[model samples]
Target: MGFKLESREASMNGVALIDDEGRWTLLHTTGERPQASPQIVASNSPSRDGAFVPEVRQPLGAVDMVLRFHVSARGGAASDDPRYVRDVNLAELTRVMRLGRISTMGLVIGGVPCVQRCVVSTSSSGEELSENIVPAAFLVKLLDGFWSAPLGEDRVAGFLRAAEGGSGPVSPVWRIEGPCQGFRAVTVDGVVCEWAGRVDVGQAAIVSGWQSWTVPASLDEWWVHPSAVSTVNVSDSSPVLPDFSGSYAVDVFVDGVKQTLATTKVSAYCGQTFI
Candidate 1:
């Protein structure tokens, strides 16, 4: 697919680069396009009978990119000026490569733009004395296999609990718009359960705009009572009542910033049979 690769430092059309803190940097002028390839990793498990089963783990490796750029004078300068191209532009690009810091990269493939966290694995540069220009290329490895959806206000809303007298798995489905960093914690009746999954939201989920996950009932520590009667007199029996109803709260952070609060209703049944 046709693509444009960009980092905080530069874009294909020669925009100024920004630092991790969103501050402007000295690098400018990027190449026309970038070359990228998809990366997928899987493992095969052998059964006792000799049959193999393939398991795919996430965050899936998404894409590796070869980014190219041209470093030149900040302002308009004559093509023959060696000082502007070599002494200034090349020096800045070299410093950036040597730092080896992880940065957010923008990839626009097939008319869609997505963001990814990546690290520069390799870099090469050569000077063109005739044109007084320095061309540099970098090999970037994507940390997360998914392209982040567009950044904006997005929410996942749905019921997290089953109906009264219902007994089954409760897989809460949420509609997520674009890409997100995922939820931090899901709180049910004041009991909090932290997310134990990949931080990067997958591209397929973003495209579908929906995702579903299950939280084990064992995680409902709040439903347990410290004081409970294991044994009771058969002649005189007392009814036991437990609270199993509350609201569900979910805290989600995008790009490390807290957005609006999203919540849903939840209920748990804790009633004893009457004989």
Candidate 2:
């Protein structure tokens, strides 16, 4: 069996786990014990005296079983405080877990079941190789019935940059302008968002016209016109690729106000790959 490598970038996000039977489960060490369901968790609020209550959690099972997890970096906005482990929708979490691959794993911040110890990140050089791996267990050990969760793990609130889609003979490139319509931002606005992905041009004709794609709460923008190819980066394929060409439109919102942005039509050709 191949050993999984983790990216060691410090992120205030929760880890996602996939079972050996193709089941997707999210592991939240938010409190002193593991939560059986994600719905029962409570949203955070200000403490009466103005102090934040930091919560830690216990592991659900044996750590030595080689628990696998995915880490995320961006959530609401880039936050220095570590209490807001990012939250994600049940469907999205399930989708990633079902794939059962190391790359599908991502950290979630400001997200549900705020994880307190594991931080997933890519190497500074941004190499896709496994040398850039680090698991949360390495940083914090499992305690008798509980793990000594990181104190500041909850203070994580920021953006979630999706990894680039890669595969086959084509290496695609992607750029996020902003949001449009009722959609969310493709890339985090106002803050600098870091993404690990490439724009892919597919061998097949994927887009006949422009299509609107919703930005998961992770990025800073709202919605933008995504050719079918842009959706590939988020697909089951190792690296998602875009396989069409067209003009894109995006809408922007600030202080609840709306705006529209457009991109000149460009060739969405799936280009040649690296050696």
Candidate 3:
């Protein structure tokens, strides 16, 4: 049960919200349960007289989270000190939280960690709970509304296999290594994106080349010499969103064969992280 905060400001970078000898002690945390952005009801969408119209749902929007901290003066400080120390700590807390752009909040409970981006909201670092203690809290607004499993959690690096269950469709950063003919990656969500044409690495034996197929962005600057037969294209429905975890069916045609290797890697941003 620990909370760590990282922000662009040097004063707040990699700071532990709770520390044994520090003034800021994390007391508790709270977050709003995920909800749709908002509902929109069409005016004339087959609604009976004076009856309710069918509403449409947008995806989850920003969420507000609270990080409560107990800012206290040092009990064992020599002389009646800490008066200066505590005030400085409070000032640091206020500036660190409110002055930054977007901060990354990381929480680890039961040895499992999850991360989310947040901006400090209005309610923060104000109330004094007692003589020597102030119950200061940083109210964080999560604009993206999704907690992402960090780049190094439960990740297997050689193939495109996402362990499903995300707030929505997560587009992974696909790395395509080659000496191959073409490549294709299909999300379990039914989103089909593939590339065609040969990866020309000259007539060298056991040679391999690499390219990263960025999601949605689809940058083609990664390849060279290989004729641009085609890039990763969407052929079917509204892209795809897989309902289950596991492999979403991927193929890298190496000499007209299937895939998997250590030299080659695919960072499947798999698994769901909740806080």
Candidate 4:
């Protein structure tokens, strides 16, 4: 069969999943779920003040896609094929499918534009015509779970939830230049997180990933998630979706911290992994 669709699109390594070439047509895509579980158990030492439910963050497991397309043998696209040139296009699709994650894979999805790093796990294709066309599909594991907008700082709404999470702003991925005693970041969505560690001029601090953060050139240079000290939970009252961005400038208060978005996108999509 054929899919009559528009307004939604996806790509891998810059190849459009849906295009006018008639080589491939995206039918349906599922598995954009961000599997974020909290770190409460990671450091679950409730000192009474720690009694709050820790933010649960996990990772998006995998995504499965269904597609249909047509091809011709003499078109120089693929091997000999009939049924209105179905297998020919299937062969053309093999290149995109074979593109492994290691070779700088680029995944951009969403109606508004979100990017992620992903690798195909498994896929299948053939000339089993469902209606004068080939039916096929693939499964991929998004390495970073949540998708971050590729460029443009002002569009990220601080968190990456799902494709239908509405039109949010770009992720405020940033870095803090030193000379500032303490740094505090409040996302466009207002999920606040802070760090008491001081940064000397020349050193910079940032939330590297969902795992741990660092302050380069600092003596202790020791690391912490910071969300552990004072942070928000999976179901923090202020928001609906989980803040997998872990862009931790949380709902906690630390005296004398700099609140700035100048460094945003400075680190280029630092720790904006969202749910």
Across 94-181, the per-residue lDDT of candidate 4 in tens digits comes to: 6675645532233344334556666766677665655335656666555554556433222123332222233322233334456544
Q: Which tens-of-lDDT digit does each residue in 97-190 have in candidate 3?
A: 7544787766652344556677876656565655567667666777665555544222233333453434343444333444444455543333
RMSD, each candidate, Å? 18.0, 22.6, 8.5, 9.1
User: Stretches of candidate 2 above 4 Å error?
Assistant: 1-104, 112-136, 139-263, 267-275
Encode model 2's per-residue lDDT on 1-275: one tens digit a residue.
23333322222223324323222222333222322211123444554443332222112332211232333322324442222221232234434333222322122322222122322222111121232221222122221222221111010111111111211112122233222111122211121111223222221112211222323324321223343334332321112222232111222222234323232211222222110
Candidate 1, 49-116: lDDT as tens digits: 44333221112334566665544444435554654545566556555554367767664533445455
Residue 137, candidate 3: C-alpha displacement in angstroms: 2.0
**lDDT of candidate model 1 versus the reference:** 0.36
Off by over 4 Å in 3: 1-12, 29-60, 81-84, 98-100, 125-127, 152-169, 179-182, 201-275
Among the numbered candidates, top lDDT falls to 3
* Top-TM-score structure, candidate number: 3
What TM-score do all the candidates reach, one by one?
A: 0.39, 0.15, 0.58, 0.53
lDDT of 3 at 192: 42
- Whole-model lDDT, candidate 4? 0.43
Give candidate 3's error at residue 103 in angstroms.
1.9
- Poorly placed runs, candidate 1 (over 4 Å): 1-57, 73-80, 96-98, 109-113, 127-129, 152-275
Native-to-model Cα distance after best TM-score fit, residue 195 in candidate 1, in Å = 10
